[model samples]
Target: MENNMTNKLPKISEAELEIMKVLWSNSPQTANEIIEELEDTMDWKPKTIRTLINRLVQKEAVSYHQDKGRMYAYFPLVSQENYLQVETKSLLQRFCGAAFKPLLVNFLKEEKLSSEDINELKRILDEKTEENKRKDR
Candidate 1:
């Protein structure tokens, strides 16, 4: 599933995002390492993951180096937060009218988060709210 990679920021596919999730959690991985992680959660073959890697490289989202005997190791060029922000903004613009409240409300209604998670989100919101107030002042 190859396509153009000329977006203002490159777009990562869901499959590639899965690989990135692994990379973000523990990056600078080998292809085999990524395959092993996927094996635990997905019914995917090595080639499929390899294809995802190639796509990521083409999108400039991943960088690789050949080691002893041409073994390839990969690293994420873009950060998880950057990717998520781009995707979230795109989603908001396209479907949510660039508003996050509706999305947040939907997520809050649908998902069960831990108290710690709730508190952390609240802290983040409060921090942003405070920053915005300062800007207005």
Candidate 2:
């Protein structure tokens, strides 16, 4: 069942992503542990947090396990990278005519990056370039 659910990606809301973040960082957290983790950062009530968790479960983005104590431990069914790929595709289609360069240029123009960040991007680009060259041969 879990394997089947993984093949279908769900559209996640920003609020739901917050709950997922908590789970992604540490799996199988109870509802209370999730609330505690986000309490300082989120200005939401316990009921609201639980509602989001419920929504995620319904969407198959999360699933619960029956622990030894008969308590339900919630864990993320969807991975963070997979969700990011969906979001990136959505953004590119919406704003950049599905073009990579325009989206990248827009981000570069808007955000200020540290030298380390720039170097890392350069390294990624260089690796991609090498892969493309190898494919051409």
The lDDT for every candidate, in the order shown, is 0.85, 0.89
Locate the minimum summed-lDDT window of 10 residues in model 2. 1-10
- State the weakest 10-residue window (summed lDDT) of model 1: 1-10
Model 2 steric clash pairs: none
- Candidate 1: clashing pairs of residues: none
TM-score, one value per model: 0.78, 0.80
**TM-score top scorer:** 2
How accurate locally is residue 46 in candidate 1, as Cα lDDT from 0 to 100?
90
Q: How accurate is candidate 1 locally (lDDT)?
A: 0.85
How much is the lDDT of residue 123 in candidate 1? 100
User: What TM-score does candidate 1 reach?
Assistant: 0.78
Misplaced by over 4 Å in model 1 are 1-7
Q: Write the per-residue lDDT of candidate 1 for residues 1-137, one digit (tens) a residue.
A: 11122235677788898988888898788999999999879889899999999999998889999888687889998877777767776788888786779788999999999999999999999999999999999
